[model samples]
Structures are given as C-alpha cells and as structure tokens.
Target: MRCNVAPHTFRSSPYFHLTRPLTRRSLKSIEDGLINAQHLDDQIPTELAPGNAAVLIPLANVMDVPGILLEVRGKMMRNHSGEVSFPGGRVDATDSSYVEAALRETREELGIGAQDIEILGQIGPPEVNLRGNMVVYPFVGFVHAGSSHSDHTNTVALDEPLPSCDLDAIRRNASQTEVDAVFHLPLSALTSPARLRASMFRGNRPYWAIGVQDLVSDIPASFKGRMKQIEHDDVDDSEIGPGKYGNLEVWGLTGWYLYLLMKKLKLYY
Candidate 1:
C-alpha cells in the first residue's frame, strides 16, 4: 500500500529546493506516534461503535513544485462546507479496511485511484468522536502529478508540464459535485519559522496550538470566546470558520498534522 520514488529523482526535480524526501525514519516515527498516542485511544468509548472515516494526505512534485493536494468542499454541502481538507469521507460498511475506505473516498472526491498513489501508512489512531459524529483515520502518501490520466490508466503523460502554481490538472479530474475547487500549497510553506504562531487554550486541560498568522485574521474578535462555547460541545457549521484567508488556512487538526509530520521530517522542532 506504499510507494517510494527514488530520493535522487525527487532531489533533482525543480522543486527540490522546496521539498524534502519523506525519509524512512520519519515514516517510522509517524506510525509509531499514531500507535502510541494514548490520548487518541482514550477518546473512544466502549459502548459507542465509532463511525469510521479516512483522509489521504497526498504529497507530490507537481510541475517541479512539491505540493500537497487539498480540497475546498462545495458550499452546498451539509458539513464542513467550503472548508479546506484532505480528500476523504466516511468508511462505508462494505469497505474492508481503513486503507480501502481512504482510497475509495479519494477516488470519489478527486478521481485519484489506488494505482496513482503510493499509500505510505496511517498517522495517529482514528481521531475519535470528532464533533461527536465520526472517527477519522488519516493516511499519508505520495501522488505523482505527471502520472495523471482521465481514464485512470498510467499510459497518458502530459504533453507539457503544468505551471508550478496551476491546479487545473487536479481540478479537471475532481468531482464538481463535492468540490468547489482544488488547490496545492507548497510543502515548503509549512516549514517557515516566521509565518508560524501559537496560542494557548488556557483551559482545564490547557494546551497550545500552532497556526499561521494572518491566515485567520478575519476571525471575529470573539473567536477565543467562542472556543469556550464549543470546548465540550458537538461541532456544527456555526463554528466552522472565520472563513478562508488569502494564504492557505492550515490550522486546527490540519495544522497539527503538519506540525507532527514536519517535526518528524526534522523541518521544525
């Protein structure tokens, strides 16, 4: 379920300066972190049958710029509408494993198939009872933008590479019904020390979260106050967003994922 591109190949690409290889040590750490996260295990309850869900953390060198694939959900959706997120949804009963559900949801959301992706493995245990509705399983993997084809066959290669910032290749294959737009943020952006900031919850279980400043600047002045409201309540769209800012809004669970992944890659401490 995993695939590896030659380290030299990734290094030689135009995006080499912006991207680093996902090393074996980091991959092992990611798996170990998830497996050993006692806090994640504690979130599940014995009586509740967790509603399983999965998401794919797809990374790739697109037109020589290494970036991660993310989706802007359609505004008409019932939940998390118009939010940026990894491609995935609930694991249907027919699915055999978390891997299957992740790949299936990815295919449904982005038209990406198992053949095009090299599944790296799981990250952390299922983030259980999220918003009190479902348990989410996150998987990290590599996606090759050059290998994309309308038919899901690997034979077709692009006549010309896409521009580094363009997302048309991915958008062309995405499901318009579920996705309003598709975008890629250079993986290099997350490692910047200056753009990152942190805030303390200062509650009973006081914790700190890292976020990109200016990314959520439009959030109402009451944003921190709202935190107290939902600190122990089920999440709803009313609490979904301060909305997207110009720069990619990588925060909350998604930001935490980047923090852990980048830390494991040794890009950040």
Candidate 2:
C-alpha cells in the first residue's frame, strides 16, 4: 500500500482502469480525508431540524479491497419493508450522541458495535426530509476484521463477535428479525459507470443509483429475481413512489445521502 498517495491521484490510478478494484491505499486515503473533512453544511436542507436518528455506513477490512454493509429490511417491517439501507435507526433517549445511536442500532441490526468501528467522520450535514418528518445524521466508519492493525481491531470480544468478513458471514450475521438479507458492495463498484444510473424522484430531483451487477459477488437467490424485475423501465412512475435501480434501489433521501457520500470519497463526481 502506498502511504502517500493523494485522493486526486485516484482519477488516474490503475485501480479504476482495472474494473474498479479498491486497494488498501485508496481506502486509507479516503479514511484520512473523512477524518479531517468538514461537514457538508450546504447540502443538508435547512427546513428540518436535527432529529434523534442516525445511520452507520460500515466499511469492512478486506485485504486488497473494502466492502460496505447494507441490509434488506425484513418483509414484516412496518416501513420500507424489503428495502435496502444502511444499518441504523432512530436515536434512543438514553443514547448520548448520534454516534452512539448509530452504533447501538448497528448492534441491534447487524451485531456490530462501537468497539468494532473506527469512525471516519459524518458523511454530510444532518439529512432532513419533509416527507418523512425525519432528520438523520450519517456516520462513516470502518469495522476492523482481524489482525491487520491492532489499533483498528477490537480484540475484546463484546458478545460473540460477528466473525468472518466473507459474503456468507455477512448474510449469516444479519438478524432474521430485522434484516431479510445482507450483502457487501465493494467501495470501487459504487462509482462504476456501468453500474450507475441517473434517477429522478418527484419527477425532478435527480440522484445516482446502483445496478444489481455492481454488487460485490454472492447476491442472495431471492434478491436476484427482484433485481431482474426492476432492471427495466416499467416502474418509473413517480406518483407510485421510490423507483428501483435494479433490485438494490438506492433512492429517496437515502439516495441523496449516498450521492453525498460518493462525492465526499471522491469516488463519484
């Protein structure tokens, strides 16, 4: 891993040229920027106030590349059932800060804890959506897997740790009660031209969405069929609500935050 590579160099890096393989050096650079980055004040809408909700964007510690964790909400979920999203929920009153809320929700949903995460930074200013009457703060963090870096790994097992950073491990770790399925998306694929499509919400607001093929291998059998159903142009009706970008639809306010995150990482323009 190159210790001194700058984020700007990513534009010309071999990583992008070779089918979007994310290297450790590239992830390190992203982490460095996030730690020191200022909040995105302008991007956050002002109509809504800071609320008691947050989400964790968890990046994994794969050797050559890192992957992000996402959840498919259980079919029984009251809101957004079977939807893909970051692992998080409304902040509890006992929680001290938004960070704690994120970690706690992650623990409840994915079995990840604050001890396992090295918080890079909050991706954007608090996200405020008038439609849902919610304001959510987004936290970017890394979950250490094994012995790569002692400082990064949480050796003290707090409750049985969710071992194995593989695809199957991610799927098995997801709580059946909360998550229908779990999948890991390589950081590189988030910005791939072939995997991205420009989508519009409310027939005006535009954001980027990811295609099913962009997923980092091992998609569940159930999700594959849904992905194919949404791959075409039949569900473009804004009046019907959020549109899918293949099966893994990343849209609505969640899509907005994803766009902000991609820009923050210099992965997407």
The prediction achieving the highest TM-score against the true structure is 2
lDDT of 2: 0.59
Highest lDDT: give the candidate number.
Answer: 2
Writing each residue's lDDT as its tens digit, candidate 1 over 201-265 gives 11111111223324322332233222332332222222123222323345445555554444444
Q: What tens digits encode model 2's per-residue C-alpha lDDT throughout 1-269?
A: 11121223224332222233333454455667665555547242323334557888887734335567777777666766656778888866667777788889987888765676767667767655455666678887767564333443334332222233555655667688787777666666665666556665434445566554345244444444444335543323231112354445555556667666666655554
| RMSD of candidates 1 onward, in order | 10.1, 8.2
Candidate 2's TM-score: 0.70
TM per prediction? 0.62, 0.70
Flag clash pairs in model 2.
none
